[model samples]
Target: MVSASSSTSSGVLDGFKLVRILDQDPKHKSANLLGEFASTANDGSASIDQAVLILEKTHFSEQFYRQLEDPNRAPTSDGERTIKAPKLDAEAAVLDGTERDAVFAAVSNLGQNDVYTWLLAWLQRSASDPGDADVKMTLIRPATQTHIDKYSAQRRVMVYETPEMYARKVQPWIASFPPSRIQWVYNILEHKKEADSILFEHPDTESGFIIVPDLKWDQKTTSSLYIQAIVHNRELTSLRDLTKDHIGMLQNIKDQASRVAFERYGLAGVQEGKPDGNVRCFLHYHPSYYHLHVHILAASFTSHPGAVVGQAHLLDDVMDLLRLGVDMKQRTLGYSLGTNSKLWSVLYPDGNPST
Candidate 1:
């Protein structure tokens, strides 16, 4: 990445103004253009000629009128084309190092590449409301081999869409893949939901929402990497004679508890092992918690494995149920559950839990 000159202050004149100009051009209104520029800048690439192309494109745009405005453009005696220098907005001046650091820290915990990717995602998501620039960065999933391959060929940016929209457009195709081959898809969906829950309902208060799809979470879930890491940790712990029997007993209890929870809740679906014993596994999204849980039970619990339960999970489940009840009550009273939210409103009689 080209480092901004430390000697110069960071200002919109160097960045936003140029972008705003380009944005006004009909030809340059395409979503991917800015991202293409950004990606080019990111890879320590983008020759001077390439940068010049972007600059030239933006500099000549109709939005450039703002920077070219001149009250003193009256004809002179010589009739020469004289233009008054445009005044810059004082507030839009370059940011000091402290200010830049503050902004960067607020947006990202990861390094520059991750931040850049996140910014691209946000811009694409917020294109509909360019004036509202409050985009938050969540987590960017690591680049897949496809992403890397595509990046080599050309810059790429992933666009964000509403869950319902995304589900309609992408989920069906993704779901068609076998579970193991699409483990990353499941992880992304889970994390996206989590991110949405975090950022949802605050959109009106804030200008926009951003979700950095958690790549690490996807990696840990989709691959055997996490299990291997855990096994290594256990080996190290095993050498210390750290109450192995106690550990074994705890494991057995956990396994049994998970099985009981799964069977009682009708979660058993996939059998982890033979019929002799139950499978102890973390099932995703049971009624207990809106999370992955360790479900355990004996072999006879069911024909397959499903979800799990724990203290936290149980509490979350109860809270969600209560929340649903409250919504149902609001609907019963002929009111909506929340201001400006249409979700779960106008509940029909069939919507009642007893029904």
Candidate 2:
């Protein structure tokens, strides 16, 4: 949550009286801004009827877009480059009514004019007309036309899965997964086949990893292992599609991973805790590659360089949000990209690299 302030500018956008209102955690710096605004008067001042907050795009790149347009472009060897944007349908499923309208408007206006510019004009209209209480105030990143089409045709469908059904249908898929797909396979069950499938001895007491050494650690200074834990008898795509069973599985894995880290690194190794090393578990909402995998890295191990806000969500926070009855899939999240990331061209064409 970034705090709103009477600031003059941010990043590149200038003039128009800028104010930073959304409160944010300093630890999580995002390249893009996704926020919600209320109709309340500015800073409790009657003279200021409305204040518009502007966030300039900082990581724009023209070459990135050019590369995206190149169908024959060579792929980078690093696993990071292999990760594609989450499926458009997955993204569309998370938006609410107001957000859906805003996105639709932005998509519809493409080619006719600059979408962001159009959005600004619409915001101005809403601010001037006091009677338009239904007007929505949300900043949206322009998406591909394919995404827009999928969003338009999307309908809400709730998926329900029982534990027994999950074990029968989903468990086999986990069991047959190749060792190459996992980061490090931990065998919890005595039987090799069973162990591979059951990464944890118990959902509440044990945990295991499906480590992929190919994916480099975000930080290289630390000696701790970078690993991902595999869930048993589950085929969850991401945190947004979590159920009560998924929540329980997540908590159990966290507990087990933390216990393992503490034993290996002691107090001196913990990054978030005092000296002892701790386990840092997180999930990417739209995983670069799809699968329900929980990252269990050592606190000392820096996260992947590509782990930007809006892209990565802490498992603990996901649990807490779900506990509060919030539907994780229905909320919009903010994310940023490095100049070298190929995703920029597919998602943002108008904004070029800042450099």
Candidate 3:
């Protein structure tokens, strides 16, 4: 008797049911498609829930040259534009007599030449950002971490919650987060994502931390060079988990993050007791994901997701609370959560909010 195993975990994207497009970034050529699928739990229970399909276009690479060698071949690029970028044209220079004749013929029609078309298109696109970029989608996956981050634009409810209320509503929700949800977080800490992009790193497993560019930031532009520092400790998830015991870890993250910002990015505020600078390191109570991380941003970035009243808490204030003998567990912590979140339902059982 032949029967399919009760297990429903399959790698194939056969029945990926698309719900809605959560968000899209034109400049980066990335998007978060929020959807769900029918599945079975480990114990073989049927279930359906949200899954983030992280779609990103692969950046231009050496494969682009392979297509040029064949001229008419396009394993990656859709079709030939004689002018993709100045660098590419220089690299794929006309080699021999036959090639030179073909090249001259292709560009003989000045009016219909794709070089003029590409250049005109490039000129208009360059107004947004100064650079040549050639990318076509090759990476798409069902995952977490960054998947939810792309859906940053959402209606958020400010939660003015006491410690007792947190224990009752928030703690259980935090507990429900499984380790499998944060494989991307693990990739960052383990140097899998950006081994070459580490701005600063402290190797100590417990109190140590690492700094890298935030997903939202375009790494090149200093105006948008928003970085993030994540502590090595996996146990610390959010502000709700902070306590007197974690003071040392908090302090180290603050100090290291600030020092690096001052030394490298030339932005400052809390490092040397200066009142003004570009870099501001802060934390979020209702972070997009479960992993504990510190947001370090340049002042020029005016519209980042978490830089608001309920979400952004500067590193200095967080550590100061511990230094001043405040019991974080008992103190009232106010933050925001998406109204669609389960925590919001618990906080506002009645569909209408009082405050």
Candidate 4:
């Protein structure tokens, strides 16, 4: 009798039945196949399912050595019959490839798992402030502690403060925007996807064109999520041209935009309307980091060319824009954005906004 056993509990052939090829020929290929399977059955890496499938499809020829005694030939029962069991080699039945490749492919088929893996890696990187040199230096911390100490001392002497310290100092700049603007910028920064720098051209040849990373969660909806907006590229244009005399103008418009967006959607919910030919919409996805976001893009917006152009967009672009505006204002005023104005102060300084 020939039987097959699996080496690993998870292998395909773990509990599969092994069929025996019956034959009497000692030199036949079937005998060799059986020997091969028996010899390598405990290798622990071969897939059991594949081996069983191969065995089931294998065929062998068997010759009968004896027949029942005929009545006419009575009493001459000296003929002997022999039986042989040859196990077929599983290799002949299964596809040819490395076992490691097969298992790796199976595990990678999970899409959500892949997404989470990338998201976690990105979050870990972003957790450190972009301005932090220590965080960047940590990238090469494997050198001796003495080397690290020298590097740290040089950086401290050359630069007034660490990257983290700089970030803290500049945070007030972000906080100066109105509450609504601050929230908007925060949403965008948190959700916006980053991509390696790439060469991009403006569709209209307009100078305002700046290449920002394309952000969209799903490719199918990319056309709807992308918008043709102002970008910040110092080389392409002066800071004045980008932020320009619009500091006060942007602030005023931002207030109006926030009030309109909040009143219309935050209170009444998203309704059908043309936000400059782009349908204004609200979406809620349970699986995303930011569950609620308002989606807007011009109806005519097209894709940008880049290796990572079609990546997912954070749902909170509008919020990001507002927050960025607030940050800019804070930088200009040199003050924190979050502090609430006292009632008496508000009356004396600017009067009740409604009044």
Candidate 5:
């Protein structure tokens, strides 16, 4: 077991094991399967509860099979194989009704992909439980190699865009700061002196929210208002580079921003018995323009372009992941791009796009 101290920053839980369950490993088949399970979750297709259920059920089945088929298959010689799995409590595998309900409510509305279908076949083969009818049906006709290859080829490629690339390629178009390209970002920077534009300013962090004119509508009739919050610190490019300090700053911004949304949107009159208007903050993993900015829009807004999983992640979820000691950079994040997007050609020069 790799110690947390060896992998993570100080003050994080030392109990958290530094294991790469997503990568293929000869020794730990079950653990490696967990990685695949995580990828399915990150794919933004299924609910978190659905993903967790699949993972736990698969894990249990793998353990059950190992005990039944090879109880004595523990490593005995140098050449012998050892199969290891994550040590999760039996109770933890099952989700309570409340937990399931909450996950269903908070799940991302990202579009589904073929990777999920391919993953079901992989899970069925790994944890073949004869007693389970669903598992049996899934295994009745296994996925063909061609189908597997097709799905694998379509999987999102996570390219770590270096600072150099961002400077050389992404920054040039934005030097003049076109309104069409960046929306309200240029306007906010240039016209912060105007009263209508500047909503809230946090002097300590040099971050603030600006009301977007073109994207805004009457919040009373329509639930969403387009507001952009900018983080003045240029060092942080995207969610991938967030630190504990940055998370703290983001939380403060979120709390204040939500209050602003509640008041500005006239939610008090509309909120009869329901919770007040929510400020849903998110960041596009591959933003249309490169900048350290968060999209602060009303929770009721559904038309925002960055709502999909391949494009966006909720800021709150990103903070929670950091608190749990997940390394965003090391983790394989899923992304999707349009066939016409220039980014696709630049990032994927080769025919194969799987990362």
Candidate 6:
């Protein structure tokens, strides 16, 4: 039970008591909390019975280095890792040897990452809930028809892309995304971000992949659990690049993904093991981003967008197609793309396609 009366000075959350956590996004430091509040019978005195409280960490401490010589407050001395501060002018930030003791005192402590994690814990912590203007109703789940209409969700159509078509259409269209649009995917594969979340990884460059939880999942419920296996090969982007020669790499990734799923998440129907758990793994076409990745979602997510016909191709089917001498590059591969997308425009220039 969590009470806000003691911690709140404005009395806005004076009677609110936390009941449970509905959802959370650890990367963003935000959570959707289900709570209950007391109410009175009086017309104007009555309060809401139940409320969903959304708490989010506003931002990270980016200017922690400036903590030093911040006149109003003395320099921090939490421990090493803090950045050394310098007085700045129009041209340069000067560090005077005369202030050695002060500079050393500040540099010798924690700041940057710590300010967002621990230092504030031992010092000062604050929360601000400004009400109506500050809160947006983002907790609505099981996206309804009205929500889809209000938001104008993009409806996609299936397009069968061939090698000749890829050269004339997809390749030229996707060129705009490399090293920029999907830079974060590279950061993950290179261990720059979410390195700790990698479940399994292959050291082989050609067949290598790392499995990580999909942000759509809460990482708690096994029924709706979702994960992704991102390929280590930076140059190989999608099914359009696959050939009979890449069968071994595809098989290796699938084998490892199955291994991790069987060992980690039970109720798994892995052929090598129990053959019991219902873990469905497939690869999306026109894949989420411009990188090669496999979507491994729980069997329960039948309504998943990727579950739609022609949207996702099963890993097993893909590998078998390769084994059967089907050339993915030359084969007419069907996939969904938004109507107004550049690829769509290129594929169906005049809104009429060739049979």
Ranked by TM-score, the better of candidates 3 and 4 is 3
Candidate 6, residues 284-341: lDDT per residue as tens digits?
A: 7777687889888776678666667687888778888888888777777777787766
Report lDDT per candidate: 0.27, 0.44, 0.64, 0.26, 0.49, 0.63
Tens-digit lDDT track of model 4 for 1-355: 1111211112322233333322222332122011112223565655322121111111221211122334544343235445444326557435544322321111111112311210000112233332111110011112233332332212111112223432454333333435553343333333343323212323322222222322552323434333212222222221112233333433332233333333333322233442222323212111022212223332334432111122223223323444466332222211111112231232224532234
Predicted structure with the largest lDDT when compared to the true one? 3
Q: Pick the candidate with the highest TM-score.
A: 6
Weakest lDDT window of 10 consecutive positions for candidate 2: 103-112
Judged by lDDT against the true structure, how good is candidate 5?
0.49
Better of 2 and 6 by TM-score: 6
In model 4, the Cα lDDT at residue 36 comes to: 15
Off by over 4 Å in 1: 1-56, 59-63, 73-176, 180-182, 192-355
Tell me the tens digit of each residue's lDDT in model 1 across 1-355.
Answer: 2122312222211222112211222443322122212224666785321111111111233433653587565445337566665436545445433334233211212223532322211122232432222332222133233332322213212222234433353234333445465344234334544444221111211112122212232222212111100111111111111132233333433443433334333334355332223333322221121212223323343322132222112222323444454321111111112211112212222433234
Count of clashing residue pairs in every prediction:
12, 29, 0, 22, 1, 4
TM-score of each: 0.18, 0.36, 0.54, 0.20, 0.44, 0.56
- Tell me how far the alpha carbon of residue 43 in candidate 6 is from the true structure, in angstroms, after superposition: 32
Model 2 over residues 1-355: C-alpha lDDT tens digits? 1122321222211212323333322344322232222333667744321222222322324545776898776566333666656445755666633333323111111112333321211222233322211122223324334323322312222223334433454334445667556433324222344443332345322232332222453323235555556654434555656755467667777776666545433423435454333656788744664356777766655645434456667888888888888865456544544433334432334545232
Reference-based TM-score, model 3: 0.54
Displacement of the residue 314 alpha carbon in candidate 3, Å: 1.0
* Candidate 6 Cα errors over 4 Å, as ranges: 1-136, 139-150, 270-277, 350-355
lDDT of 3: 0.64
Q: How many Å off is the CA of 103 in candidate 3?
A: 36
